[model samples]
Target chain A: MEPVLTALSAGTSVDVLIAALFGSAFGLVFGAIPGLTFTMALALVLPITFALQPTAAIAMLLSTYIGGASGGTVAAILIGVPGTPSSAASVADGHALTRAGKASLTIATATIVSTLGGLFSLVIMLFAVNLLAQVALSFGPAEIFALVIFGMSTICGLAERSMVRGMIGGALGLMAMTIGQDPIDGVPRMTFGSVQLLQGIDLLVAMIGLFAIPQVVETLAGHRAGHQMKIDTSSIKVQLPTLRFLFSYRWNILRSSLLGTIVGAIPGTGGPIAAFLAYSQEKRLAKHPETWGKGDMGGVIAPETANNAVTGGAMIPMLGLGIPGDPATAIILGGFLIHGIQPGPLLFTERPDVIYTVYFLFALSYVLVTILQLLGVRLFVQALRVPHQILALIISVMCVVGSFSIRNSFFDVGAMIVIGFFGYVLQKCRIPLTPILLGLVLGPTMEREFRTAMIMSEGSLSIFSQSPTALVFFGFALLIVAFHVVGSIRSRSAGEARPA
Target chain B: MTTPALRDRWTGLVILLVAIAWIIGSEYVIPSGYSGSAFGPRTFPTGLGILLAILAVVLIAGTFRRRDTLPPPAPSDAVDEPAKVSTRDEMWGAAATFGFLIIYFVAMQVLGFMLATVLLVATFNYFVLGSRSLVTTGAVALGLGVGVWYLMGHLLGVYLPTGMLGLGV
Candidate 1:
């Protein structure tokens, strides 16, 4: 409180605030656009922040991060296309509401609930950073590896098609991660002579190519406006959820928030999985579970809240442990490098100013997004009215430029074109790309930690099982697998009992 | 791919053969030296090859173990058999995009970023959107090509290529 007050009294610069607002608005627009994710938005904005004051820079980036994560709900609700993977579950009920002509209500509810949830976690995250930092300092490679295993176990929970297929997908991702250099040895194993291959596959290139490019192709090819997606201006009201409803489902929301926070605290798990798990939990707990996929307000709120909360939750590990929470935070970590501020446990002691600025940024995201919600709902919906032809053309160009811009090399553009085509093929074959993205993001880190831990312990499996924290996480992973196995068997048997 | 178990088995065999080729390429072609010596770069890819082979075997066995759900009969036979009709056009479009991309890659090196990106985006857009307006097409092509050039070159400070005229600056 004292630090925040000091910073506030240091002078409230309108310039910084306006810059933050602009960044947030851009993030909002990018986020609402299908295929441009929070991470991509952050990466695009990161290099640009090289020329701003540290406070303004951090503030703008943080606001954009929050805005982008929350903004995905708009596309998810209206077009049945999740703008970001975090908002995928939102499409279930969100699009249903749109089909039922309550698109405005759904969007408003998502925006407001997202803000509240973000603010809630932001406050807690700010106050508890010290304590969380203390806990994070205790984690080592074994604990980290266990956490990765737990994250990988989420494939069982998230696989919509079949558990076996999901495991296969995750295994394939693990294999893909193994394609680069061996972490301990620094041995370049996978690169087949091409200088570009030695640096290993860039996950950003893979992600954009996989998620963004395919969507461009699909939209261009299908080119169908399924229904007239109209937002009733008057219906855009953020009604407070009923007291009775809150009391009834308080436990679930709290649990989901905690789930999101914990996952966020473990760097690289990110928001999509958090939101998916929350929605799954909500569905499992609902009195009428059938209402979930159709159009349940609770379904919309649960994941929205959990996903937004992830912004603050992710910061916990990033600021405390110097580990990035996702591709977005990885870029933010790069921002810290530009500012000559090394982010780790010492960052708090060395530069409380930057830390305070980060806190202020979180608060400002709430303010900016809430205001944007009030003002720009109509404008945003109208922008979505752009014809598919123009949008596809624009996005494809952006994809090419974005890939090339990453490195001065034309090789990256070539990589993007290749990966984009691969993604298209994968989509046609019904292979999901999210797991592949997960592989690219977490793969290298997981392999390094696993191998280093193994070599340190002289190839002993006990290292993964010995530590209490490791053992606990390992147990949780097994429990998740067991639960899914039982659930699938039960569902299959029930299906067998019923008439076809 | 739309064939019976035997056909699917053959497809899996082909995929397995391709996986083997990829493994060989990674092992023989990739330079082994970087930092560590005892366990070099080729270890993981080699291991992955083994794993893939094992998995392929399992897949083959699984294919054989499963009871084949053959299409029952025509609709006139009192049962509406599940239609296995493939969306071949979508598949071909996807393949064509891949082919186009290969051409774009070659063209990028020769024709440069501006021309190649414009042509690629315009051509892909035409095929995908089927937008026939020449004026609209030209505008889109220019908009995309120049927009990318300005954004990457000026705004982001990314150094893209300047082929032939050397006009990237």
Candidate 2:
């Protein structure tokens, strides 16, 4: 309680509060753009945070995290572009609701429910942080390895249409991870003697390239040609959800929030999966399931709430265990690392002050972001009308600039372009990019843990078997894989039974 | 013949070759130090290579067996789907954009972000966006370029390259 008070005191300071507002505004603007994403936005701001006090820097980044997490819904609702990857599930029903001439209601419901979900998760974070920290304290290298596998196994559940392509994407990312120095030993692998490869591919550059550059090309090719987003703002009305309307979905919101928090607490899963899972569950349970893709208000609420809940859920592992729940959190973890803070069980014990500061700022960021968003909705909606060609050109140049800014290396720009093309080709083939991002983030960790575990066990593979926590995670991973294989076989037979 | 399945097969073949190359490459690389640890750096890459090869094979084989069906028609509800461009036009647009970006990146160091951005934005405005008014194009380019330059370099204090010309603030 004393730590909380201390942190809260610092959090409410003028400088920290000011930083939070600026970060939230930056995140909202970036996240509301179609090609820009939470990860890219955070990465771009990461260098600037270097100059601030630790608490202020983290508070600002956390604000950006909170804002970016929810801001994606704006683009998803208005244009179906999914401003950030987390908002992907929101697009289907969100855009449908907009077309049905309820754009304002959909947006308002999204904003309100998202804030509620975030607060709900923050409550969970307060209650569960200590227990989670205790659990993390028990993990060994083998357990960590199994945890990574469990995280990787999510690719199976996330795979759409084909698990094979998704797995291939994961493999590609893992291969990319092996490009730099081996984590366990400082020995270089796959560098091909290039000095630049010594530090490995910058994940930030790869992320921007993979997410932004392809969108630029795709926008230039497809969207501007005439397939532009035709949003009729003049006829559209923005109406806030009434008390009755908001109260009606109380049970659904609670269920989605709990589900999202649980998924978020897990090592590998984050917002998109949680949003999709929550949305699909609601869709399945709805009385009129046929209304789901057509313009159901429940559809908007479920994904938005779930994704917002993910903000708190993602922070759980980052703060308690030092493992990032998703790519955005991973980048935030990078921010923590840059401040000379190693986040693990030790963090809670050694820096309870910082932990409480995080908690206070994390909750406050939601309030600040919501206010900013309400005041800027008109401005943001106007952003939707900007020409796609201009957006594409700006994004392309920024991608180059942003990539170069990461290390001030031209080589990074080229790497981003190359990865962008690869991402473009894979996206065209319907291969999911999320798994690849997950793999890249977790691959090095997995390798290091596995090697460390083996060394401890004197080269015996049974170290994985011996650890109870590892066995549990491995069991979870196996169950997911089993589910995928069974699901694949069932779908294949169903296809076979169909009329030729 | 123009089915998505055929296209997938080609992609799978390319992946297969890459995976095989990855495997071969993993074996040949000599690390500077020999480790007494049970698992060396090669373990993960070798495993990933095998996984990639297996998946590629499965994908290619599945393509041969699975019946290729056309995608369902676009939903009438879609308001903002991408417009279709001809392959030739798409290539041209891509080349123009990519070409411009590469030049901008190179010039950013020598001419600084401000001047290079001005040049790129002006050129793109004229050629790519096809803006007819030179005055509007130049003004918009100069404004945006200098605005961002001032924001990043002056306000944010991020150091942009001061190239041979040293056109920086």
Give me the TM-scores for chain A across all models, comma-separated. Answer: 0.72, 0.85
Query: Which 10 consecutive residues of model 1 chain A have the lowest summed lDDT?
Result: A224-233
After TM-score superposition, what is the CA distance of residue A267 in candidate 1 from its true location, in Å?
9.4
Model 1 interface RMSD, one decimal = 4.8
What are the lDDT figures for the candidates, one per model? 0.67, 0.79
lDDT of 2 by residue, A354-399 (tens): 8888888988899998887876787766767777777676667667
User: A1-500 in candidate 1: lDDT tens per residue?
Assistant: 67767566432587678768867886887788765576666655654465566776677788788888888888888778787889988898988988887776678767877876787777678766777566755767787778667766664344434444444445555566665555665656556556777677765566557656776665544353222234333444444445675566566667767777766666436788889988998888888998888988778888888888888887876677565656577566656765777666667766676677778777877788778865787666565666654765576656665666666566877888878876676555444555555555556656666666766777677887778988987898889778877886677678557655
TM-scores for candidates 1 onward, in order: 0.74, 0.87
Tens-digit lDDT string for candidate 1 (B40-83):
45655666566556655655664565444554334586444222
The 10 consecutive residues of candidate 1 chain B with the worst lDDT sum are B78-87
For model 2, the DockQ equals 0.54
